[model samples]
Target chain A: MIDVKSLSKHYGTHHAVDGISFSIGEGEIVGFLGPNGAGKTTTLRVLTCFHPATAGSATVAGYDVFTQSEQVRAQIGYLPESVPMYPEMRVREYLHFRGKLRGMTREQRETSLRGVVERCWLGDVVDRPIGQLSKGFRQRVGLADALLHNPPVLILDEPTVGLDPSQIRETRRLIGELAQQHTVLLSSHILPEVEATCQRIIIINRGRIVASGTPEELRERVAGTSGLIVELKAAWTEIEPALRGLSGVTEVRGTPDGSWTRVALRAAGDQREAVAALAAGRGWPLRELRREIATLEDFFVKIVAGAHEAQTVPVE
Target chain B: MRNTTAIMNRELLSLFCSPVAYIVIAGFLLVTGVLAVFTGSFKPGAPATLRMVFEFTPYALAFIVPAIAMRTISEEYRSGTIEALMTAPVSDAQLVLGKFLASLVFYVIMIATTLVYLMLMMVYGAPDLGASLAAYIGLILVGTMFVALGVLASSLTKNQIVAWMIAAVPLLVFVWFSGWISRAAEGWWREVFRIVNISLHLDQFNRGLIDTEGVVFFLCTAAFFLFLAVKVVESRRWR
Candidate 1:
């Protein structure tokens, strides 16, 4: 339930977020993937109404951010990149204050505070001072505060940063659960976390949207050729020539690990069988040979690198 | 209005939770009490009364109010809590008013603690109760003006120390140099300097004179600074 149209933010000469447009539907989990200084935080800040866009506009829950900011803010919950919390406040007290700030009555605040504490797994430390908690717990408290008002939209920037592996997994699961009820716009540099948690991904670079699609869609679009890495008891001099002579073999490189060779193959169709037979015919012991499925990480690297190349190339 | 009250409550609660409110009140009472006693034995100079308490308050406020307000907006900016606050369902005016009101309340509490001086005057000598009340009213008005200026200073920077310095410098200049400028000027220039001089306006109140002009002047100054603070915060959102 969020719509951003040609949104841009400039700090004098530095453009933090260029003309970027995207819409998120209700109950959909969208991940904003970008490296540092990639405008993810700027975009989220605009949607949350923390910062007004220098040009263009955004609407949340059918309210204009520039004119109807109060209504927009009332409908969206934002957890900024840095979880800003009062260290002196207890977990429950902080949640209560946040709920009141979001326009909840006393009874409503108590009810929502209970739900947030349980949902974010903040029960054990509800009475503890927030500053005394571990980083993981502090992150959870931040999440709890965002969820305190039960807003229909959530804008979380790097929600899983600095958390241990277990906490990260738990946060991912919580986000997945949240998606069933609330529209989530999550920003993160961790590719796997985005892949595991978001149904759609938007990759941004240098204040521009480079690509947007499902994880598999992006992976397939960027991964044009499939290859196999085979570890075998063979020398590069002996296996390189044979694989080169194959019908679909495009390139092959041997690693210094004398027993392994990575072969890049191009074929009109599935070429797994051709490579398998070639390995079988050579009678060279094949230890491992499997088609490499391109991952989100590979797609991200290729897209960002390609954007960098396009920027550097001179135009006529 | 609900949001403003909520914010005001939170700000007041935060002040009490820390030692800030208590320390400010205690320090103010202790200092003013000592000054009142020390000035009492001055051979009955200038009709010794609670006027000295009001006379020293603006100078005291020149330092204490900044300390109370330096963290109002600066701490939020530094800790990144301003992001969350700005995203709440509150307008810029509401936020500014809420913070100003909270600091004003603290200033009142600090001023209220000096009532011991009034009680002592009642016991030792027949100090003019009407004049004493008028002076107390004047002190509150001047204190409100200082609080508003402090809030403006806090809004200009995220660094609390810098905010404190910014707030204190202007106040010190106005209090100390306004008299100097008044002396340096002739007819109209001197009168204008005296009118603009905060301490000069405050002197009328301490003398048991309820000059409506002085009251309006302090209020207008407070409103002007608070308006500037709101504008500063609004401009920051675009940046």
Candidate 2:
């Protein structure tokens, strides 16, 4: 129920969110994945009508974000990244205040408050002041506030950022449960948080949509390749040239060994068989043969490992 | 209308919760007492009217109203609460008016405490009740405009101290300096300053004169500042 096209937000010389566009369909829980300072929060803010886009357009529930801000805001419930709240207000009072601000009637507010408080597990601390609450409780309070209006759309930014491990799991579970009733668009830098809760992941880097796909699709396309490691008595001279010659072998590196050579090769699919044949044909004594690293974190390390100036960030 | 009331109620709650509200109230009463009662106005031989209290109120409100209103918008901006607040269904006009009215209400409550001075007048002398009522109305109008001006200043910055200064400097100029500068100026310049001087407007009411023209001026001035506040708030998107 949210659509954006060619959106750009610039602050003088720095482009916070350069031209980028994405859409979240109804009942879909999409994860906006990006490292810090990525344009995720900026994009969410534009959708929530907190600010106007420098160029292009955005609509929430078919209401224009810029021109029809109040209507757009009414259709969506947003939890800001900082979880801005009145510190002095009790959790119950604060939620009621938010409900009023959303134009919910007293009856609607009362009914919604009960559901959200229980859903967010804000039962006992409802009467306690927010300032006195811990960070985890504060995050829950922010979540509860977002859910209190019961809008059809929920836009949450880093919903589990400061939570404890258990709280993180609970928030993920809550978002999963919320998907049944509300279309959610949550942004986070953590990979598993996105993978654990989102049906689709949109990876943004340097204000651009570098990748967007389902977790499995992303794993296959972005992290489909595996790394090859071979330990042998061969010299770096023969191993480098021969391994680089193999098909789908994109990168090769060697680490110092005691009168032995250990080489690491990054290649598409698997190159273990090829390397074994090469060692046999070259008449070099082979010690070990295996796929060095080929897990999700290989994707994490490949994309984020900085191992060889990876193609994670495209050269603009 | 409902959104406006919601914001106004929230503003009142926040105002009452902070120490600044009580400080402003106590400060105002202290200043008003020194200026009108303790120094001269309600003495043995002097006139036992609330004329002194009404005359000096605008001066006291010059500082008091800003202290009450500096947090109305600046705190939200500083604490980053403006995101949620502005993104709610509330309009910019509603937020501005709600805050302006909240400050006005707090000022009224503070001024109500001065009614004890009126009761004191009831003890020894025959106070002019009609004039006293007119003065109260006049003060409320002046307070309305002052609160609007303060809200406008608060909207311009996220610093409460800066907001207070921004509202106070012009307020002092409008209330105190205008009358003095008008006395020094010649020709229409003098008349211009005199007509624009807020004290001159309050003077008409101190004598129990409810000038419809002054009433319109106060209301229009208030509306003008509130309009500026709304514009200033809307300008955030450009940043």
Candidate 3:
């Protein structure tokens, strides 16, 4: 439903987004993952037609964002990062106003208002003024406003930023449900939220897309080998030599408590059985021995850190 | 057009839902009433009428209309609501025009409250009915032009105080320099100054003269500022 080609945004000398290209299918839930100042918001703003790209083109639902912005706007719903709202307005009234602004008739707006209020779980406070609500409720109200027009695509920037853990989980569930009907492009700096909610992930760093794939694919691509951490009730002098003597053991580091040592086993496949047998042979009590598989967080940190280091490296 | 109406309705409703509309109306009436009573002794033998109310409205509007319009677009920009509004399926022209019309309506309501001065003139003295009506019409035309200028000023910055200052500066120039130019210059320069002088043009209407030139001046002023407001909003999209 969205196609961005050579999309770039420059504020004078600073390039906020640089030549990034990506596309998302009709009902797919795609997560845009990046750290702060990673150009996620800039990319989303370009796609939403809030700001024009400096040197690229983007289309949404077959409408060019630069030339046919009205059509593009009609086809997509955007919830900006800050979720700007008129605090004096009631929840229902604000949604109704937003629906009308999106070209819905009064009858249509009324019907959609009911649906959004229920979907965003804003029934209890729909009549209260927005200024009085807590931050979590305000975020829900922003989501409700975005959903009121029932556009085919939804672009939400940090939809779960300030919510408590329960609210975050609830928002993730709601986004998952939304994906069944609407194409979603969810942008966030939080790794686990995107992993739990999105089917596909696009990692951006320093105004570029460093990686894009399914969560499992990214884990496999960025994570070269599986590591087994064997914590033993022995001194580093004894445990380090024993683990390094094994075939798959690559490195070992002592835990802070000094009561145990953690060993990293580097292998293409599972080496749990090999490590377990070695522990059994040694007669050393193994407090914990678990394989350390890389998660989305690990992949994100590695990619972002690598990008930062690459940018800081001096050339000859 | 549909978007404009939707935005206009929302803006008008918001104005009423808050205390802004009421406070503006009350403030305009109270100021006009007190000025008329205090200045009545210096009337220079002019007939008792709404002429006094019309004569002082431009001065009151130089300050009051900016307060009403200072936040029209500036607050939206500062609070990031402009992102939501501009990203909707509406053109910049529609958004600017909708906001301009909404502020114009509020200006009219504020001007409308000064009708009490007219009622008082009718009850207390034989005021010139024709001059009074002409002056009321002039007041509204001048107020609409000022309000449009305020909207354009508000569109130029995200700071409401800055917008208020920008709106007030030109009105201040018109107030302070128009008389100076009329006295210092002769013939053509004085004519040009009078033509561009908003308050000077307003004097013709307050004197019961329905000059078409004065009417056109007020309308052209409003249109020019509105066009500038639309341009300002469009520039933001590119930046």
Give the best candidate by lDDT: 2
Tell me, by TM-score, which candidate is best: 2
Which segments of candidate 1 are over 4 A away from where they belong?
A230-248, A255-269, A279-288, A303-316, B41-48
Backbone clashes, each candidate: 0, 1, 0
Q: After superposition, how far is residue B195 of candidate 1 from its true place, in Å?
A: 0.6
DockQ of each candidate, alpha-carbon based: 0.77, 0.78, 0.78
Superposition error at A127 for model 2 (Å): 0.6
Cα lDDT of model 3 by residue, B115-193, tens digit: 7767766766778888877887888888778889899999999999999999988887776577788778899989878
Q: Judge candidate 3 at residue A35 and give its lDDT.
A: 92
What TM-score does each of the candidates earn?
Answer: 0.91, 0.95, 0.91
iRMSD values, candidates in order: 1.3, 1.1, 1.0
The residue pairs that clash in candidate 1, if any, are: none
Residue-level lDDT tens digits of model 3 in A1-316: 9999999999999999999999999999999999999999999999999999999899999999999999999988899999999888888888888887888889999888889889888999999998899999999998998888888999999999999999999999999999999999999998888889999998888898878888888777645667777777777787777777767566566664576666555666677887788778988788787888867677677666778653432121
Tens-digit lDDT track of model 2 for A1-316: 9898999999888998988988889999999988788789999999998888899898889999988888988888888999988998999999998998887899999998999899899999999999899888998998998888888999999999889999899899999999999999999988888999999988776687777878887776654667777898977887789888999999999985987898888899878888899889999899988885444445644444442444443223
Clashing pairs in model 2, backbone N/Cα/C closer than 3 A? A301-A305
